[model samples]
Target: MRRWLVLVSVAAALAGGCSQAQDASSIETTARDFFGAVSDEDGQRACALLSSDARESLETGGDSCDEEITKLRLEGGEAGRPEIWGEQARVRMGSDTVFLTRWASAWRITAAGCERRVGEPYDCEVEG
Candidate 1:
């Protein structure tokens, strides 16, 4: 059920403009690095890979961004192909789906551990 939802949301996000890049390789690389950081339990590095908005979101409540991010228990695997549209991108791994947006010269994660909803947006564990 969740996989279906993520797929749908990814498809929906891709319906917008074409990817700004000639190919989505850069987006894939960014997603891979983000997940690798998480898997390695390098909270600071993971946080650095997020969009400012996502960083702010992670830092909400009483925890610092780095502390909060590590507490989420995120799991990731090798990334599959990426779907990018303009500044937005979706990358799927073996167990999770990540959403990213381009900011300045880099791609940053906007959401992770996202699951699709029947009539709403993807529900993400980490979202900006």
Candidate 2:
């Protein structure tokens, strides 16, 4: 079950629509860019893709916190394409896994209701 989820998530991340280029890689790329910005401590850029709560967390926690999040990389979850029709996205970077969302063919990081770990490698939430 987990493996299937991984496959689907990866497929979702890599594809998108341009009309919209819905393939898993497209979404993954969005996640990749977003993470890169965050790692660079570009909160404004990262926040642009983050959920409302994520934005709030960064606002309250400040630059240090945001930079920490940025450090995480978007690893796998690509079957060489992108697909839409989902509210969430997942990708792996090194030993890390990231969750993102879809807006048409565009992807953004999901921060609302997602549990964050301070000074730790993972900040994730299980979908209910």
Best by lDDT: 1
How well is each residue in 1-128 modelled by candidate 2, as lDDT tens digits? 99999999878766633334444666667666665665667756766776655555554345543554455443323233333456665555444455667656566665422334688745553221
Per-residue accuracy of model 1 over 28-82 as CA lDDT, tens digit each:
7777888788877788999999999999998878888888888886787778888
Model 2: C-alpha RMSD to truth? Answer: 10.7
* Model 2's TM-score against the true structure: 0.50
Residue 47 lDDT, candidate 1, scale 0-100:
92
Query: What is the TM-score of each predicted model, taking all chains together?
Result: 0.78, 0.50
Those runs of model 1 whose alpha carbons end farther than 4 Å from true positions after fitting are 1-23
Q: lDDT of model 2 at residue 20?
A: 49
